[model samples]
Target chain A: MKKNEVPQDKSNLESVNFKELCYAVDENGEYTTAHSTGWDPKTIALNKAIEEIHERTENAKQRVLNNTTSPIEYYMELHKMDLPILSSYVGFWKWRVKRHFKPKVFNKLPQKTLQKYADVFDISIDKLKNIADGN
Target chain B: MEIKFTHHQSAHCENGVVSNLMKHNGFNISEPMVFGIGSGLLFCYIPFLKVNHAPAITYRSMPGSIFKRFAKRVGIKIKHEKFSNPKDAKVRLDQNLANNNPVGLQVGVYNLEYFPDEYRFHFNAHNLIVYGKENNTYLISDPVMESVTSLSEKQLEKVRFAKGAFAPKGHIYYPTNFPKELNIESAIIKGIKQTCRDMLAPVPIVGVKGIRMVAKLIRKWPKKKGTKVANHYLGQIVRMQEEIGTGGGGFRYIFAAFLQESSKILKNPKLAELSTEMTQIGDLWRDFALDLSRIYKNRSAKEDAYNNVAIQLETIADKEEVFFKALKKAI
Candidate 1:
């Protein structure tokens, strides 16, 4: 790729940070180098990913407040996991997981089950339970 | 203790680490050269595996394979270890630094505090070099960064022991020996042949054919799944292409640069011509990404947008099939 060759009509160099070295080619057809003017298109794409994850987290938080789902759902979404993954991690069947998505079912879950989930998420059981309260 | 090491950032981490390691041993090699010599280019779309709830779509080989294969081809002996205890790992790392050896560390990106908040993710295969340690901080030379940085000992411990898919498990690697001379000709030829074999592998969800498989799956997505799911899938593909490194062309541009350098090293004009073709193909990928982005940003996008993307992907697969076939014989 032509280093520092910004694609047209995509971005401006206004906020660009030209500190990172990027690989370019010299007139000799050999590998040369140039600093990145950080407004590269890849930065835009990365920002989009961050936005998507943020939105998912926010939506999960809203779901917990409405009591439509339990804190387990919120934690799973925060950890970027689906029901299947969470089920396998906790060694519970998918149906058990679906049941656990309810506030009542989750509140009554065994300490062992909560500990398994907390371990998988690398968080304490208290933090896992109080996730909806922004703990 | 600190080792005298120079850092140069690159588009991808593995190739950059390998290139720096080569330079540390007094062999000046570009990241693209290391990438090509390792036969790093690949495509895979495994629906059974999910990354962030979308099917896993990888642009290159498994993590660390590129460096492993490159080191083997260059006849370099490298010491790699994984520790059960972080304390022991820290001791070993400090010992290596005291011996004037820089260590490559595999750590998760999620907990690397130096990274911009927007750029940090749960990726576990991120590679960085630790060259020195102060009272509480360790000097880090992450390939994707603008310059060298530092991390606290506590912060380093968290990332090193990060738990997730492809956990690092306190893994560290450093070169122990280097060949006196390299047979560039044989290495280039072997690299090219291996890349060709990998691209043409018979697996339905791997290699160039894998691109086609994803295209087919995408075409059916809007109908088989709902528009919301299909659009999310489109966003995921673009994410794999542009966000997770190799700069915006899904590694096609980097590989094209590699082919260009290889042509000069091997004195083959055909390879140079093929390198130009590869650049055009890379541009095609960029165009497809641009189109996909429009679909992702527009929730009310027409139903045909998914089909349009599928068509673009199949065209890419067709071009790549011919490109690799020619590459197989170009050597």
Candidate 2:
């Protein structure tokens, strides 16, 4: 990519006060560093991934609302985490985490286990126990 | 107490951190030169390892390998430590800062408050430096950022001990000694040779072969996994290549820049010529990424979008195979 041709498409990065630094060839064909506000292709790809995360979060929220799944599922998606990742953070086995996704299994859990999940999600025990309306 | 440090932004985090740290210690090493000597360029597609719900695709070497390799080649004695507990990590970092030393740290990107929301993921290989602490905030020199920033003690600790894959458990490193002068010519040759060997490795999951493997998988994904999963996987490829701090074109441009700098230092005009060719190849990778985004975004008019992109990747792989061969012969 040439220095002049570096993409400056405004992106989500602009909201966070960051600009990506790209290496581009200058007019003399020498490599130089250039700051890009964003590139369209990258933005599109990133947005798609984020969209998927949001969709999952929404679906999980619905499941929790119906009492089919626990709030653990909803909060996991809200934090952009999957079962394996959430398991690692909470120091729980994969099977145990999968079990916790069930409303019955999660409700019977003790304070210590709930505390672990609460800490990993950075939420209070009450918040983990109760999903606020419209959230 | 804070050590006086100057920040220089680079295209990649590890290169920038190493370059900036070297400068702080009175050694002026450019980021490209550091990257070259460290042999940071690589391509690996780990099918068994899932990151972000897609197969892990890495465009560079494992995290911290660049600094480790660079320090060894250039006769720098570095001290590396990892803490099982955050308290010990905090103590050691404070000790380094108290002694007027700026230490490099391996941190996760997810909890880094200064990072853009779009870029914040579960990636744990990001590097930065802590020069000093004031009150409760630590002065940070994240080389990817335009200017230096600060992170609170709590925020810093959270990222330092970030869990999951490639988790950096409070890792801290700094150079303890440096040679009177660097062996630039010898180091450049070693770096180039190692990079060539890596790119041409016989392994199916690494180097040029790995790129080909990804291409093959792309061709099968749509039919085997359905369009939704296929597009998600494709988006993962694009994100790995273009979204991360790859300096554009998945570190191809950076490698090319390294070659251009090496050409002058090694007095080999052939390297300069190859550098231009590499740039063209980098452009091709960029094109590949663009086409991929189009397909995932449902904007592609091409009938066989997945197949077209797969072909494009194969073309890139073929070019890279030839390019690495020539790069090896050039030195």
RMSD, one per candidate, in order:
3.3, 1.3
Error of 2 at B253 (Å): 0.4
Off by over 4 Å in 1: A1-4, A8-48, A66-68, A79-105, A108-128, A131-135
Q: Give the TM-score of candidate 2.
A: 0.98
User: Chain B TM-score, candidate 2?
Assistant: 0.98
Error of 1 at B135 (Å): 1.1
Q: What lDDT would candidate 2 get against the real structure? A: 0.90
Task: Please give me the total number of clashing residue pairs in predicted model 2.
Answer: 0
Tens-digit lDDT track of model 2 for B1-331: 6678998888789999999999988888999899999999999998888877888898999888999899989889999999998999999999999999999999999899988776788888999999999998999999989899999999999999998888999999999998899888888999999999998999999999999999899988887988888889988988889874799999999999999999998899999999999999999999998888888888333448888988999999999999999989999
- Residue A49 in candidate 2, Cα distance off native in Å: 0.6
Candidate 2 CAPRI grade: medium
- State TM-scores per candidate: 0.88, 0.98
DockQ of structure 1: 0.31
